[model samples]
Target: MKKTTLLILLLFSLKSIGQQSKLKITIDERIETLYSVAFFNDYFLINNHENLYKNTLKNKLNILKNHKAVQLFDSLSTKYNFSYYRTVEWILQYSNFPEFNKTKNKADDYSTVSENKQFLLEEFKDELIKFNQDTLFQKYLKAVKPLNAKIISQVQNSTTIDELPSYLEEYYGKKLNSYNLILSPLLHAGGFNSEIINENGEKEVYALLGPNGEIDFVPYFDKDFIETDLILHEFGHSFVNPLMVKYENHVESLSSKYFTKELEKNGTNQGYSEWKYIFNELLLRATTIQITRQKFGNEKAEKLLNFEKSVGFELVENIVEILKEYELNRHKYVTFDEFYPILIERMK
Candidate 1:
């Protein structure tokens, strides 16, 4: 073909690709929460100071006014749902997600490069030692040691996963024969994976109960740590699914009706201040749960012993960037597959 004709054809092909491309922008939901309300609620939960609830309304509104989302949402507050947490994801625009097709370029999946845990643990001892020196970790270790002893003691007598069924039935007083789950959480080197469910949900958590009705521990322990406390937290959701389902309906029954009415208010307040209040509240209420733990108790010694707060403050700084990125990419549906790297980048 002539050079001029070839150039024309190439231009047309490029134009066609752009025309057919699904890279068009779309509107994010118009509804959103004002910082004033979310921040106030967070403050009350965190400090347990009833006076925080009675703060001047003007002071509360000023807290999160700097936040861009707070401003945008405040302008469109009329379109919001009952709560921002429940209804932030107001729309789903279905399209082909961005695929890297990086099978050839991607690193190989983690594998058993070593023969066993004894060798792997030894090899990674330096990294392990670093985590071991945590001042706050003494209590965590004390709690885990007894649990580890229980498993080790059971290993000699309770040989199989089937044996766990009877052991659990006697210990827990529940017939779990029908509810079976197998967990092998290979912390050092294992593929974190899934369970049988009605649909493919990335966030689903399930466990296997043996014939006698307990965690099928022995079978999976050689392969992984099945009884990690984080696992129990996931199972708790399912355990109280019925009660959690009705919590919204009767929330006022368990609490003062006046307070409930205040929480439902919305005003465009400063976003950062609002988030600080809410985030601090979460930190306070998040239980350590060895037996029973309370944060910032009336005890003077407890109040004096405090985290530097620098670490958490830094974490919040990076999370704000993450929130901004999410807002900017609502049209593109861009997302970070892993937030850890950004966290490290900001911290270190």
Candidate 2:
């Protein structure tokens, strides 16, 4: 009886270890509110998809077109070079409306909020609450609830979503405490990710993805879009960006040597102006290619590699080759970070 009990307990432990966590896919009211304000303030005016807020919600929320929050955002955008993704990052630090306090720190101690902006947000807290209350944001959320439910249901059923955590954890040799996929109807074509170190010192990652369009009054995600762009690429940033910070000097030196004017121009056009940003993006894209190859197949991976190169990431193929070496020598390297310097040296 004792021997049989031990065997059953050991099998249960192995089964538990084998089970990977699925992504938590839902619409966040805080993100929706922030983007709604941004949309009315003309923040998404440039390079965003035509399908942004084109559904029934657009006309219903027009009363907030001139809200104080919108005015403040407009003025701030004019005064500073506040990129769309930067704005999203700033908003992610704050708690949900009515309080709007900065409750979350950026993961890995990278501060995205300027001290001046921080102070301004603290001062503007009441007005933000007023904006939320007066504009009937809860009512807007209620209207969006069913659409949110539909998208969540669709995403929960995705095989790619189910497979992502295991693939990423195995690749990085690090486990995230949680994964969240937040759907934003107002975000359009842009996808953003936030890595937050929670109060418990656990890493929580969020993939903020936009809707492609509404189908029969419900927001829809293109299967290919979710699998490749939103899932692999965006979440890959969480793993890659923090690791690159330690090698910033090496990246800058490499950029000086190889990041040509044309490459800088291409990178700047895609919102990656700095050497570190471009380097981090190259690493992330390369890793995404490698993960795709492992998860899907070589043909799909080759197609993605070609697409990335066409879009100005010319060095991605080389990075992918380096990543291949890392994969084969996991006994020597252990983690991708351990093999990063080899990548830096080979890039030269």
Candidate 3:
């Protein structure tokens, strides 16, 4: 009887571990609150304070802004072309804190901020250490920790994280359980962002869930909202970015022709180099629209398309016909490799 019980318990434990949700959600109140302190301080420094979180954060942001640690960060930012907030991000990623510890790879160098191939944090390691030790940042973090429960509830209601993978699977007509998702609910003040990083020889997506201004203070749950759109948009990057890199030569050859001066000038707003940026932007946008249309009906998809156009992706609507053709004739093109080249040829 004892042997049977042990075997049963072991099997149950294995089952539980195996059945764990591919979508892992965490409300990293400390990291988000820390970033909020920096972001709000930066915002106030540039413009008159008009944020919704001003009343909750003004004093904290002010204190952080005046701290010697932040001053050192500012000086370093000038030298490095990366902001103090970015340094804080790197600190949280590298710190003893569990929330951020697994978000970066052990192999990648953190000397420079990865995005945009920007400045070196290695040069200012001492300054970064000093900034992380600042009493003000710690105090502000403690003061705001109590509000995390409420903030987490608000963010959960505003976005649909739990059902996202299932939605993506149903839309794309494939199994996506291999891809692990890290849903980090950031403070309402911080903006939304997402990135894919390789950690422990596995690809993990760290996505920031921020304020949904569309339904501000009106508590309701709907995955079809723009919150889903934002997630799909970022997730689309995880799909398209790697493929672009995999087919770098093919992408480069086509990019020069497709990326006209008009597209370059229009797409440079995000600081990405013109042709490469435009190509990625269009690929991600089209992927977003295709999957969104599958999950939601035509009306919602049309709204998403127009929204992309209004944001300066004026050529996206024309791609829909080609994507439709791809879907109808999918058997001919088994992979994106087969489909993408043909699609680009049609673009010509």
Each prediction's Cα lDDT score? 0.27, 0.74, 0.54
Q: 14-51 in candidate 3: lDDT tens per residue?
A: 99987665565554543444445345346222223233
Clashes of each: 14, 0, 0
List runs of model 3 lying over 4 Å from the truth: 1-20, 33-37, 40-54, 75-79, 83-93, 98-136, 157-160, 169-199, 214-226, 255-257, 330-338
Candidate 2: pairs in clash = none
- Each model's TM-score, in the order given? 0.20, 0.87, 0.72
Best by lDDT: 2
What's model 3's overall lDDT? Answer: 0.54
229: Cα error in model 3, Å: 1.5
Could you give the C-alpha RMSD of every candidate to the true structure, in order shown? 27.7, 3.4, 5.4
Per-residue lDDT tens digits for candidate 2, residues 104-123, read: 76665544446667655554
Which candidate, 1 or 3, would have the higher TM-score against the true structure? 3
Off by over 4 Å in 2: 1-22, 45-53, 108-113
